[model samples]
Target: MNQHVASGGTAEAIAALVSRFGDRALTGLSVRDLHAHDESHHPASRPDIVVFPNSTEEVAEIAAIANRYRVPIVPFGAGSGLEGGAIPVAGGISLDTSRLDRILDIRPDDMIVRVEAGVRRQEMNRQLRDTGLFFPVDPGADASIGGMVSTGASGTNAVRFGVMRENVLGLTVVTADGRIVRTGSLARKSSSGYDLTRLFVGSEGTLGIVTEVILRLHPIPDAVSAIAGFQTLAGAVSAVIDIKRAGLSIGRVELLDEALVAVINRHETLALAPLPTLFFEFHGNPESIATLSDVIAAIVADHGGTPLRWAKNADEARRIWETRRVGLGWAKAERPGAQSWPTDVCVPLSSLADAVLDTHADIRASQIPAYIVGHVGDGNFHCVFMSDPDDAQEQAEVHRLAGRIVVRALAVGGTATGEHGVGLGKRAFQEAEHGAEAVALMRTLKVALDPLNILNPGKILPELADPEHSN
Candidate 1:
């Protein structure tokens, strides 16, 4: 009834997992060594057992078994996360939620949809295409909606549409002690007690295992216009602030650092200036769209940024946008078998240019071949560094580099993580970023919901921060 580390590389402990979940759970699971980590430089640590649960009831049953043994349970999504959220650090049970892939209902009138935890963002988007509605919160990877909501996911669209916390309507969760509870409702507004959905949405699966999610959807844009251009780093960021100030109903506003742009050019097979860029997408009626584009172009030109360059037509727009959609994965595939350290730090809107320029300066000094990308309209950015985990020095450098960036973000009144939730990677910054009082409240909530600390332990909250010392 205690957490087990992956000390034994033998099958004896693995037999225990097979004994409970049957051969199907044990047979043909991902390579055990591979399962030991997420998409980060976190050293690989295997779970004592891995169980695949196919439904909410099955998840509850699995939870009961895990509780009986008092083994730690780490819920996993697509493993595309940079924060190591899905890594089973305590070596107990890596509960796989990929099998619960079902879309329960699409309430067009209410503009909401209910889905199982295993549903991927792009997969759900495919299903919603026909209804002229789509889920807007995409976290780069086709991350599972359940996982997205679990980590309060956000991405390019977040600048306009908000994150998972703003989009999710309700959740069906299995508590640590094997209790089934449905939180929140389909209603748009709830003066309900505690606002439970928001709590679990960004809880990083520490409170409970979310089995199902009800999410708000947006009407498919009547037309999407994407414009990509290169500019000096300072100019690109300034242009983004200007666009927001002008009140453009933009759908996606992104910035790619010059170093990152070169990678995109090589990996994505496109040629452009090797300078920081601002990618813009406007969604609205034709009249507003034209006027807004003109306003945005003039602003960019004023700041020495490139003029708006778009696809000649809608078909070309889709093609151009598709390139950006797969940008992260494309970059990942560039270096085979390497893990990416994605740093997401968001600064105050007014100080965005300063924050970005400072971070860029740091990146330039680092040895890591890093690429910077962001949902810049919101002053949130990601610098993805590809590195081999086996390389000790490189990994250590990444850790230090990432840590400095976090400190910088906190200095600017920003967070350690902007969109990607605090998983294993950001745990070190817990005290430095959030003060003593705030962190204590978080710990109190964690204890209240998951008394045994069985649900995704060792994430978000630091191991044991001296509240008063705050480090």
Candidate 2:
């Protein structure tokens, strides 16, 4: 079976799917349009049909059908991706996993939880409230667990608990050839054969469809949160570096520029000074929390930062983090009738100040209504650009500025993206960041695992010479 099939097979594939799934498989224009794109600025490209699979067996069946007909299978989660990962660029079947929302088991003794693909983060936490444990990889959005695994996502909590690559211990994956395979184990560490769990974690659904995940959970610790204003972006970032260097187990530290701070204050109805600021959270016992708070406050004062304003209660702390969580929304609200082009990059802790300061200057000079926010504790930050979608010149400028940010990050030995996977936007920078040889090995793995290339085609890897096409 050739991997690349003519468009004619797509109709047959959709018909076969509809026959098996009945009304669950939809061919309506509205449904197709809804699955066309994600939160990305990428242009929408609808799939031929959208199928909702209910179980691991059904997902496997869908993969088999797509493989047999050589139809692309794009997995759909909550549609929260910002890089066009879920878009069916090749126009085949969009496999919606929304029906697979089941929490299989909770092993509080082992500190782990098993969940189906469609389970959202917030819902999972709610279910785990009684377990005295929680899943910590929060990308702001109440993203699906499987989607978070696919993107290898991380957010504020990543500074302490790590990302999906570290937290996910096992996966039940549906291969491109309709086979169900299990990778990793519940046991913490294993010198096993191949770390397939990590490989598929960030493949962006190009390799396989993750049906379920076994995640490592952390205990809910006593926490304290505070906000500090900085005289300059450098001061705020410098304070973060010092905090990390001090070897304190900081739970979360985020940086929001003055512009974004202003937006959040107006949108969230909070009174935070319109200055470059850092939101800090510490987790531990009451004693350790108090010590961490005092030490960090003194450090902030050393860097010309204002006195740390501690959140008085749980509600106050929630409100403080809400400002950081909705940074992109506030950016869009700051400029109505404009599309946001959000991009992020990561650098060494030593190079973070230079990278952020330079990007801030670049955004200012471009005269674009953009703001910067960062998980600076982990050397990662994001810039959201607001531009008119219909204005070609403005779009081009936004693209140019985004490209420059990536280039600067790469120059400083940083990655093009820190959290957002290379769905479509970051594909071009793969070679520059990972070198030709590394990317070639990735292509080899893609071809080996998905010979038919029916799983989420045209993502991650760039348009290199297809070995199958070469004479």
Candidate with maximal TM-score: 2
Tens-digit lDDT track for model 1 on 168-208? 88999999888888989999879989888888988877889
lDDT of 1 at 46: 79
Candidate number of the best lDDT = 2
| Model 1 clashing-pair count | 0
lDDT of the structure predicted as candidate 2: 0.89
Residue 132 alpha-carbon offset, candidate 2, angstroms: 0.6
- lDDT for 105 in candidate 2 is 93
lDDT of 2 by residue, 41-80 (tens): 9989999999999999999999888987888999999999
With a 3 Å backbone cut-off (N, CA, C), the pairs that clash in candidate 2 are none
Residue 44 miss distance in model 2 (angstroms): 0.5
